[model samples]
Target: MRRWHALLWLLGLLALAGCTRMDLAYRNLDTLIPWTLDDYLDMNREQKHWFEDRLAEHLRWHCQTQLPGYLPWLDRFEQGVAERSLDDRALRTLTDEAEQAAAAVAVQITPSAVELLQQLNDQQVSDLKVAFAKDIAKRHAEKVAPPLEEQIQKRAGNMIKRLEPWLGDLHPQQLAAVQSWARQLGEHDRIALEARARWQRALLEALAHRREPGFDTRVAQLLQRRDSLWPAAYKEERARSEAAARQLTLELLRLSDADQRGQLIERLQHLRERFASLRCLN
Candidate 1:
């Protein structure tokens, strides 16, 4: 199902606030998903129309049913920030919550994804493989070929940019903290690249047998059990990176000034209000 977009939107609801582009991405996700999906497999007119209908259903379901539940979590986060209690444990709990939310969305969308998979002809499947190869090459060149030091620097810069809106201009020590955390998680590009290849290979294999009697069940299992399919090394590295990131976030929050905290609280409040306004209780 390529559940990253749903997962990202769900997770984004947990922490981020003021990125207009991200907000637009969620608002226009139906269009964006098709555009992104086209990179892997282009759909014919009939399939595209089916996809659009299913996407609209998903969007409406998400907005009307799923989004409202996030309000409580957002309130808890805002309260955590207000009380200066967003520590490592709290962060881990939030991560679990977000993962569960994403999993729920994945389960909901699996049937539609299976239907789409059944529609793919041989040429489309070949095109999908070609797309995967192209993506792997592009990612390798962009993320892997860069020198280690450069990658660290670039990652640190991106972290700073993402945080600056909420935290304002960071001090030297704060920037150093980001750099240190990034350096600690060094060279995950290969792991991610390999993981992508494995996922795509699995997808291709599943497509190859799409005509089997239990194809729907197989596809559902593939999408819903995506984490279980991950290589153990990838899981371990991902966990380590997540823990380090949590520690870094807590440290940064501890280092932030009152003004920065005030700004963050304001942003959180704005997001909470925005989310609350979208409740379609009918």
Candidate 2:
């Protein structure tokens, strides 16, 4: 289930909030899953048809029900952005709502996931394990295997890239804040990788007993409540990371010039309009 979890992040807040191609991405949600699953599961034709039907149903429910809630949430975020008052509390509130939104998607998809997963042969399971190993290795090389200083610099650079789209080019003070935040994160990239690897291990273990009783429950936990798989250090580091992100946001906003704030408001408005205009594509 964690195989599709990245889509939860990629298709939701991160995509909607940052990507220039949000509309295209949102429109492709129905097809995204089958494509993403190719990395983990190579389904037979009948299984693919069955999953497509379920995915279509889930997509309809999401477009009809879940997406409406996002409009109000985006409005709230835009309100704070326009007012130049996105405090830590407001940011945390939005983050919590985003987590809830992701959980809902996971809940909706779990039944389909469980049904399809239970049908996988042992060869498919072995392939999944191999796929996971490759993914973890690639992620580690990209994010965790780097020297600490290099990682910090790349992290800051990436933050600047994401922020510039919404906040415009950051002031020097804002750039400094970003660097500080990145440095403060220290070994967090490693912690995040460890947590993800732990989750995958837990998932593979669960799959070994996929036909046993309580399998659905195990998949639900794996899908919906992955925090239980986190190392204790990861949990603590996650809190620190969130706090650093909030502080960085506050610093960036405080340092932003009037033009940057204006650009931010305009961008948020454009994003809201774009999302609002996305019809429920079948």
Candidate 3:
């Protein structure tokens, strides 16, 4: 009986190991080039939905599988920050990971688009590359020119404008409270923007130094470090944003009329259900 029980335990351990391996493989596959809105725009309605569903499913799987790996590192970083024990090495390591993760994901996704482009004639592929390059340049300009804080304030102001009509029958005080919440969101956005910029700068710097010997090895090291850090940073930031969202939702619910609140809740629920239904293609 003891031997049988030991055999069962060993089988269970093998099953768990298999599950972890499967999850890691799924993440690696999912992180391979994300399908953008532009990819779906050329498709028929049904095709567009199908593509979106597949894209979302893959992205969700990637997040679920990869994010857990970084949590311990991030928790340590956060704790260090809280305790004022943060060191340059820790910050640099985190920054390096963020840059590498971004690049790795980009590289993974790029092949899919490249494959699609291969099906096109030379001229068509050239045109597509040109268009893509132009978009990238424009984005680069925006990134370089915008003071992260100002850009965030502009976006927050825009969100407030968008939400104003939905905020029904609020007293002056309540309206002011909502505006205050918007300002807080703007502040959060600025922090995120700064973080993104720091990561981008790190990546660019690494690329600039790529002519040195062992460049590929260095690049691999950076990405491996990032793979260890980025997901946890992402999760920490997401949790903070979600907490704010819950707080805002509660405040909005209090200020909104019964009908408006119900309508908002219903709309949110429907959207959530729609998102949940998305699946990635095999």
Candidate 4:
């Protein structure tokens, strides 16, 4: 019973962590474009929820579950993080452990993603790979277009306008204060808009002049910063959590009878194949 309780607690914690990771990932995805905070926030409540839930579910199933299997040593590393009195070295050790765990999980899961597609017939799998590649290219194109940002901003402005009348019952002073804040925000937004416009113009000018070196370098730097900096912290945290989860899964796998283990392996193989195919396209 105690073990069961511990398992439930771990799962709950994992679910929360998975949700947080999903939110961070989606926010980063949007940030990869020139879109504003308001534009992302202006998504309908249901749409936002769906995005969060979908990614969370995917992470829980693909990342969270498989992580434990690959990195069984994470349990001790995670326990160190939970302790309030851990020193810097201990923390550093935990971070290193997490990095290794996450890398292992990523490597393991990526290949399995390909197997997932194999569960489909050969033709269906081929179609899926093509479709996945096309979708990724479409998303990449959207990210590169400043016009999408402008369109999102325009939609957000319209939403704010539509909401203003509904919020008009406040005191005159309150309304004035709110309007002042809005104006200041709008000014800041305009600066960002101008910057994006300049970037777009520079890209076009670079293209016309065949001056690819500087432009390509700048883009490469931006992408490098994103890859090196942003995900590291989250990756560390995810590694710790996944390590704990992996420990749990190892125990579960151990207790499972041979037939059950076989079934689990088959399912895992399918998931891995699908994920691999997606990565190949990306």
Candidate 5:
């Protein structure tokens, strides 16, 4: 269920220009996430009720506690854009803040995940393994089977789509720069697939011993300290990819024109208002 953490990034991205879309999606997330989980492990009535109740509690905690915190980050980002003072250090700081916020949420939810996993029957565990295998195979086919050049092109295209909401259309030079950045980003699909397989393998191993003492501690560490479980090679490759991305983002910001800067500030401002509105409704 750590995959559910990706929702935070999605919410952040969509907040820039699609708050209405994000709001609707966020409201339905409790429902949508259960549907996704049911694909992997079908829960019995009691477990389903427990999960729904826990999810509701987590959502309320996130809205009441976490959403308000984003205001300061947005304010800083807006000021940086307005003053043309954004730099790599500032970007790193922002990234760290976001990670900390997500980690807090992960900590809050880890106990619930452990409780639910510990209750899974053998048949459900088998179903989970099947689901993991199916997901890995699908990802390998889609992400790894592509030719290298095609993969780079697709990666750059996806980055453009994400950036365009705040940056608007990229200039020809910017597009070329993005393509170059994509090429230099070390081969990620293979390493990422390996990392996912490794994590799932570890999870299944942990789940199989669910009745053992300290099982909850082990599972909590697995979920929150996941980086420790990554293959060293994968860790290195992922770090390289992330550093390349950060460099690319900083360069893009440095090259942004007045209109692009204004657009970014406006988008951030709009996101601030949206967060405020959501908190007030809470």
Candidate 6:
């Protein structure tokens, strides 16, 4: 959201900022909407008003329809944690389902995105291209410019930070396992960014043809067919990354103590309750 344009953010809305802030952010969508527009494009006053209104409807649909579905997903995942039965297969299933949820949200908003994009004038389109280039440059600097060892350590640190919220402080073995996992995924960030570059280029090309026939179909394929759109190297890297992550997860769960598992269960339960308590249709 910080880097992408408004439409790009909408297409990738499933990447919530944090595990703990999910409910608060969802409930305050209006306040959060401005982040998507910042430094990305120059939507005029009328266009901004229109997009905001349409975005509201989309969020409402998500709250009322999409979120309920997640409760069950969390249920299954929490059960896996409680039962300590989350092998690689279970992890893969959960990951696949999460991707499907992301696809659903992307597909739902693509029409609105298409409509708004077709309204952009020539100058706005030029600004968008510049913004896209800037986004890639920023990502490259942050992700690819770092030395290999530094990137690996930073990646490990981030993984620990995310897991600590749910798993509590990792002991020596779990910490080592996490670091090993990160080391195994060497150069992953670079691979991911290359795929992102391809995706961004594809979007711009499709946008260039926004006024032509079959433009919507092209955009739809871009958003919904993510794995297909990815370059072959990216696809291979993704598979490797997922396999490594699942193995690391399985190992960590095996190494976790009762207290850590209990903490994880508590976090999942809290998330479920938080989601269920929200009044969506107001």
TM-score of each: 0.90, 0.89, 0.37, 0.24, 0.88, 0.88
1-282, model 4: which lDDT tens digit per residue? 011011112222231132133223333332211211122123346544554554344445544454344233333433333332344444345445544544443343332222221223444434534544554445444433446445446434543343233222333443343343333333333333334344334323333323333544443332222233324444454445445433322333333344543443343344334433442133
Cα deviation at 80, candidate 6, in Å, is: 1.2
Q: Which candidate gets the maximum TM-score versus the true structure?
A: 1
Ranking by TM-score: 1, 2, 5, 6, 3, 4
Which of candidates 3 and 4 reaches a greater TM-score? Answer: 3
- How high is the CA lDDT of each candidate model? 0.73, 0.74, 0.43, 0.35, 0.72, 0.74
lDDT by residue for model 5 over 220-247, one digit each (tens)? 7776787889889998987777667667
lDDT by residue for model 6 over 173-219, one digit each (tens)? 99899899889999999999988788878977888889999998987
The residue ranges of model 3 lying beyond 4 angstroms of the native Cα positions read: 1-156, 162-173, 184-190, 206-245, 272-282
| Lowest lDDT block of 10, candidate 1 | 12-21
- Which segments of model 6 are wrong by more than 4 Å? 1-39
How well does model 5 score by local distance difference test?
0.72
Which pairs of residues collide in candidate 2?
Answer: none
Off by over 4 Å in 5: 1-3, 10-36, 279-282
Instruction: Report the error of model 3 at residue 124, Å.
Output: 19
Candidate 3: global Cα-lDDT? 0.43
Q: Return the top candidate by lDDT.
A: 2
Which lDDT tens digits does candidate 1 get at residues 229-269? 78998998878877877778778778888998898879768
Ranking according to lDDT, highest score first:
2, 6, 1, 5, 3, 4
- On residues 1-282, what C-alpha lDDT tens digit does candidate 2 reach at each position? 123654445333332133333433454566434223666778889887887687778777877778777777767866776787788787778777767877887877788878888988999999999999999999999998989999999998987887777777777888888899889999988998889889889988998999999999998988878787778999999888877766776777778888987887687677667667767722
